[model samples]
Target: MRVHIILAAVFWCGFVDSRKIRGISSSYKRFYRERKSFLCIDGSKILPFEQVNDDYCDCEDGSDEPGTSACPRGRFYCTNLGFRPHYIPSSRVNDGICDCCDASDEYNSHAHCQNTCWNLGQRERAYVEGQMRTLDEGLRLKQQLIEEGVLLWREKQAQLRELQQVAEDLQIKLEEHRRRKNEADRLKEQTLKALEAGDSGLIRQNSTVTSVFQLLDSNKDGSITVDELQARVALIHDEERVLSEDEAVALLGGGHQMELTKFRHTLWDILTKGDSVKIKDTLGAPDSLGGEDPHLKAADRAAKWEATNLKKVEEAYDTVNMEISDLQKKLTIDYGTDWEFLFLNNQCYKLKVYEYTYTLCPFNQVTQKNTAGTEVSLGHFFCIVCQTLTRRTVCVLGGCGP
Candidate 1:
């Protein structure tokens, strides 16, 4: 028996033997119920079931002759199978229109529609699956980047916290050392005045800052450099516990050499004040957390530290904020128009033919990219299924399909 299908209807002509009809969908399966020697389309009218598709209308609703043009208002269902099905008016039955992929609508016509059903089905299935794979890959990458963004945010937060704490510690230590240095300088000045006034008894006691300076004047040049200072490096340790070469030079008035006055200044602090804290360049590195500016006066180091620290901290904070904004933008793009289309959000779909390349970017715009030169805008893209078939159904010829 030959089976002919039209839109949503099925009929047996019992004359021509050919391909089998694919199983009906759940929505149309209800029509097959309550079958007997005689059946009505609605089971309300009784007619021989054999009368179906006999080229004449029977049921008032025109459901009996579903596969033929027996009723003007009846509908035919095309079981497109692998693709989406469509409905056609029953009057179009055998009217030479290729309404169904299986060509059952023109089943009895001499120019019988060829069975392009399986070929079209296979092609459409492959296209849909390929599209799905592309979306899946994009979704995976988007998810991975989002996770990385979150990790980066946490790491930056921790780094900023650590930087803040280190800067604070440096500030406190720098202040304490500056104060101790001041106290030591005052004592040295007082002792110098007493010596100039001819305090011979105190001089003989050999406990003056001048005596420490004279001991350090190894070359008798009445000054010191890194080379001369190395000899009394141990004494330097005793005073400040440690001193960098740069700081040593800075204490001597911003030169490679320190004269007697400069030597006395630090020497008094070190020798008379054994418990005095040593000054370290805690603040001024190429990219230090915080520290004093060596070239400035000791009084200004505190202010400089605060200013420089604030600048660096603010810059770092702004960088973190910008990164957060970028991540948020990525997130917005990751889930475009709808969750299913997230991969397509901000994404461009292209189809290249002989003459031009067509592009569709969801929720953005459409364009035709000429293969030879310039591209032109076609229209705006939107959400219809999120916006299904916006404007019109896009189609292309040849063996290819979208």
Candidate 2:
């Protein structure tokens, strides 16, 4: 009788220490009571409490057979107290394979499962901590890049404004130079017309006309003889003939010889006015009196110089305008909400694959080069998509693309 009492006491102690329900988590233990009748978790039916985990399915929802594989939809819980808690399907229980880290799923099977949940949980926590640190560092660096990129964008805006001002200044200068060129051209035309109309007072006083007379007077006698005029190669009658004696005398006012005063009065008009008179080459060359008046030449040179200056100013203006256009286009781009991608504006990256090398210039173009150094344009920088700035979906046929 004393032995029976001791055994009964031990059983009571064991029952109190482990008020166990198989397969149920601690949170669900209140539902499974030791009452005479048991209710299904879905309120489908009531059964004898002894029917729970009895290796038979009664409840349509499989709530009465949580600990057994008798119900196909039943679930089994593993109370991995030292690590993490989770649930396993009822089918995985006692199938000769351990599905729970606590080895409880194979309790009726021959397979042995070790309780490795605590060690696995430690490794998982370490990995998660490392990933957290990496993420924190990455975010910090990203913020730093955003700050620098904003400054870069500001600098670009300033540069664009300065260029626009320069373009405006260049446009004003270009207009001024064009005006000067037009004025010089008009003055040149008027001077040539006045000289052609036999304005002899200017011709007589001119040093260039005196020089020509001296050149024609080979004997230096202050008079140009027909022999002297014939001796000089300055006169050409036509393409196939030299000047004749009669033509030379006629050029000197119907006389065999003429003084400088008469020669100037007659020969100057003939040389300047008529298409019948042809001067062959420059002053010191074989055709000595070849060109028009020196004053008119000087005016022509001044006009030409002004034109050249105008052209240079126009070119400068155009260059500045092109720069302004490019800057405006760049500013309109969506680098990022915070200009975080502004640093990659003119940057390039190269990648090699097989025998080809691909080059990517951000906000510019993409090119591919073969091993033989043949480069072909693959595409240009279209709009950014999917948060990657360099990736593009199309090509344009132009200076920046295929």
Candidate 3:
């Protein structure tokens, strides 16, 4: 009977042990499912707690079973009342040092950890609030600046409208002035055309006389002897003179006789008579009228016209320059000083005025000035290739002789 009792007791104990083992296995599987680290050796999903304290790394990230420290690089968070939550590495999770201000890293059942997390949490909250307050103040200042910018924009818009009105008025005046100038130009052009026509007629007449004279003087000897020339002169003067062999050769053709006679009459008549005469009065002396110097009078009239046009052009240019100056001033006021303006007006002016002939000197002088310890006032050099001024001394060295 006793033996039977012992056997029964042993069986019961074995059954209980088996049940406990099964329960542990079930719990491990449930935790593995929740954490998704099950079957880690074969790359299957299971719970984190199942592999938490396993000697071998089971999960790829090793985030399982925070209670039993396993993975060295894992993180754990401790909830501390009245204190900011803190995270510690898995290696420190069970180090028994109680590093967390709240001492929450130690399990509630553990005896060694103490509580100070509430004070740390309050301090952290206060620090964050202070930062928020500073940010709020800065935001308010930015808003004020934005308002000022808006007001400035409104004023600029008003100024732009005024400027536009001024521009329009100036444009209207310019158009009127242009119209007057154009009319004046047209009148001047007509006068010039009339003068050109008169001059052209005289030139044509002169050309005809020249052609006739060239035909008569076929040998192109330039001049006739006094005796031979007298014969031709006498033909116009109505006197007698002797002709020579040279004269006979020169007067080979007689077709120019009538034209020459007509030319003589026109010249003498214009010089002697002062009144305008009909074109048919070719046999009479010219009328010398009024003692007027036509050449001088025409030149004076042309000068007067040019002066008037120049004045008008100057006025137009002045108006344009004024507008440009005003626009430049407005731009400078709206934006800032323009570096390009300084560069063009100052630097370029200096380069143009002083640099033209400085390039003819020796390179040694240039180098001396460049390296001079004192404030050396070195002149600029002219670059023949680029047609600009430069300070570089070595450029174009040993080139063509100056």
Candidate 4:
């Protein structure tokens, strides 16, 4: 009777807006039969249906409950026309999380969620664009530094090689001098022995010694005068040996001739042995040459130069790599799984407060420095809180700002 008529009206409720009609996909151009009859979504049952948006479950598969939270497995579709359509669980439909910009999911919520999806979309667009722009600029700068650092490292290495070669050349020169000294000593000893054995042909170990002495006697005198000897003596040793006039003449041993006998005694050791001791000193004494001037000073300077440049190049190379590593880590943290954020790597963000200046160098670290030359480390960029703080702050956007 009257109750049967109400029940019949419920089974015939057809699909309306978004819900599938009769819970099945069939061409129903015209409801030739009685239009009030309806089928369950799974075709397992039949019922007379009306407005299904009544916040009640009418099907086992929850197909009859689309907008309400009556069914846990029900899916709600959001017609986010300003952005894009999306779906969410029925349980989260009215959870107050603003999952949908259209606010369709919160239709039954006690807390009023406004339809601010259009404004939110605009803000998101602006933020994303700004982030990309800043990232691009920051990346460009970092790339420049990287390029400069690479070239610097290469140039340093080349200079080092050149210096090393100079040092090696100097080393070779010293070794040759040593060999000559040994030969001279052997010759002097042999000549001395021959004189004692009465070999007249070997009276002078070397005729060149006599010739040099004669040239040093600039006054055309057979002997070296005091003034003549002292002037030339400074050139013989690696360090200057300024002999007084009397001291110079005393080297002659009361001889009228600047003979080989006198010349062989004073300053002769270095003349024969080659002043290699002072040369070895310039290299910072890495070794004694396994035993241990010139040409000796030039070689010394070259060796020292090479050592200094080698250290410089090593430090630069290490620093560049560390900077690159820090930048890469920071980029990932700032923009989750997005490669565009890599542009922000190695970038610095700075803020100026009332009396202090704060700086955050992506991935490297955070630091605060006052105007009075005082600096303190806030934390490393890798730390979660430290990185988050840097992102959340916009006091004075530096290189990473768009």
lDDT string, candidate 4, 284-329, tens digits? 3311211211222322333334344445555555555555554434
In candidate 3, what are the lDDT values of residues 72-103, reduced to their tens digit? Answer: 65555665557755567756665677866766
Better model by TM-score: candidate 1 vs candidate 4: 1
TM-score of each: 0.41, 0.64, 0.37, 0.41
Model 2 TM: 0.64
Number of the top TM-score candidate: 2
- CA shift at 100, candidate 3, in angstroms? 2.0
Supply candidate 2's per-residue lDDT for 72: 89
Q: In angstroms, how far off is 243's CA in candidate 3?
A: 81
Window of ten residues with lowest summed lDDT in model 3:
334-343
Clashes of each: 13, 0, 26, 13
Best by lDDT: 2
lDDT at 184, model 1: 39
Clashes of 2: 0
lDDT of 4 at 97: 73
Error of 1 at 235 (Å): 18
> Residue 102 in model 2: shift from native, Å?
3.0
Question: How would the candidate models be sorted by lDDT, starting from the highest?
Answer: 2, 1, 4, 3
Instruction: List the candidates ranked by TM-score, beginning with the highest.
Output: 2, 1, 4, 3
**lDDT tens readout by residue for model 2, 24-74:** 887888889788988999999999987888889999888888888999889
